[model samples]
Target: MPPIAMPPGLKLAQDVMTPAEETELIALIEGSGLAYTPYDKGNTRSSTSYGWKYDYANDSFVPCKPIPEGFRTIAERAAAAAGLSCDDFAECLLNRYEPGAVIQPHLDKPVWEHVVGISLGVPTTMVFREPASGEERPVELSPRSLYVLADDARYVWQHSLPPMQGTRYSITFRTFSAEGLRRLEACPAEI
Candidate 1:
């Protein structure tokens, strides 16, 4: 396949975390004691939200558990790598994907703006598609690597993960958009 040019505002950094850090993050996720709920087809993708929970069933956002210290530290690094401020990140989501689990193509909620994601445990390819044009691009994500989606990449294209070779965990951080900020101000958050 021909190499696909990355869309504007999409950035990826390789080896953002050391193997030791990756191991530690995985351990922290395992010990966090947060509820992981399955929301995808066949119950293959389970996730827990921090700072704010996204109600997939209702397609709305709600306040949830605060971001854990371990994740917060990494999120800060991710924010810096993405050229964003850690303070701007208001939500964190941890997704656990079982082998062969797939995430269908879809855009994120408009309430969120920039997105930073850290990949762990397994390597996988994320395919981004332009809905109107149907043009697709595939980006491989290695364990401990980080990827950022903003601007056109965040709003114009839809992204999804194909079936994986092994269990994988993605730690995602998102910043609230103007609309999200307004909503946040109106809602009483847990933290």
Candidate 2:
């Protein structure tokens, strides 16, 4: 397959999902019976994890439920669009951001190679910063759009979203590294 043309390590597709599709997906997430919790520390957003949950205290993945069917469908389509293998992703994190919620700047942990995010509800600006140059680039995330971060963007640049204007949600799909896969397998609980 030809590589998807993208900016260095980032791929973005706007209007990837229709409004109705976005609404349906959001409803599915809300009704999925997953445990959505606030960041144990200080974050304002709430999130639910599938396949693996990050244990902030231990800095590792703990067993979690399998990815929901609705999320799997979206992840598969986004992976195909980004020129990635659908099976590569084994986890999904669903985040719900209320108005005034903010995400701090941080690079995704090394356990996950690629980060694919599907934006729903409302639009927001996601800012990416180069660690070496300290330069910043802001991208507007339109509702029903998809963004993928890989390579340098995944490892070198840190991304964040400012306080939001309205309630918004994002579904992020992540692929585990070899070590991460082993960790998941070694866990006693089924994921």
Candidate 3:
């Protein structure tokens, strides 16, 4: 991925919690397996709970975790980051990873609507870039931190957490209205 300057209204924030909070968060991810997944080492693929599929061999969004919080506070922040309020936000999925797990590089794919992500638990590095220009930038996200991707960031860029060796967590923020959910049978989301 190439490195393209972020557009206006974009904010990437890190370290949303204190060290004590980070420790507590690590306990949450390791214990919950929000990162719980089965990996095909030969193919480098894994699954969480979202029912989204991932084909690491091809670097595509196959399937993975669901938005765990159902689009709560963090969703609000993501919306805010996009210049929208909570009303414009929709769902959230928690990516929980334990030691020695790896997620391949791929974008969220267009099937879903909008997306937002926050890093939590142990720190992790996310790969990003200007999709059109092939510019790349790798960012390390800390526990309790928030990342809002919208506008050109939404359609023009690709992102992934790659592989990691320790406990790590990522909460993705997404948006779709109730009416919007009515349009998609699978999106009502049991809040």
lDDT scores for all predictions? 0.83, 0.80, 0.56
lDDT: worst 10-residue window of model 1: 32-41
TM-scores of the models, in the given order? 0.91, 0.88, 0.63
- Residues 86-109 of candidate 1 have per-residue lDDT tens digits of 877778888778888888898888
Candidates ranked, most accurate by lDDT first: 1, 2, 3
Pairs of residues clashing in candidate 2 = none
**Deviating ranges (above 4 Å) for candidate 2:** 1-7, 33-42
Return whichever of 2 and 3 wins on lDDT. Answer: 2
Clashes of 3: 24
RMSD of each: 1.8, 4.4, 5.9
In terms of lDDT, which candidate is strongest? Answer: 1
**TM-score-based ranking:** 1, 2, 3
Across 1-191, the per-residue lDDT of candidate 3 in tens digits comes to 66545543346876655667656644544454433333444433222434333334553333344444433445566676667776554444556666665666565555445666767666777667776778776766776787776666566666666666666666565655343444445432333
In model 3, what lDDT does residue 99 have? 67
Model 1 residue runs over 4 Å out of place are 34-41
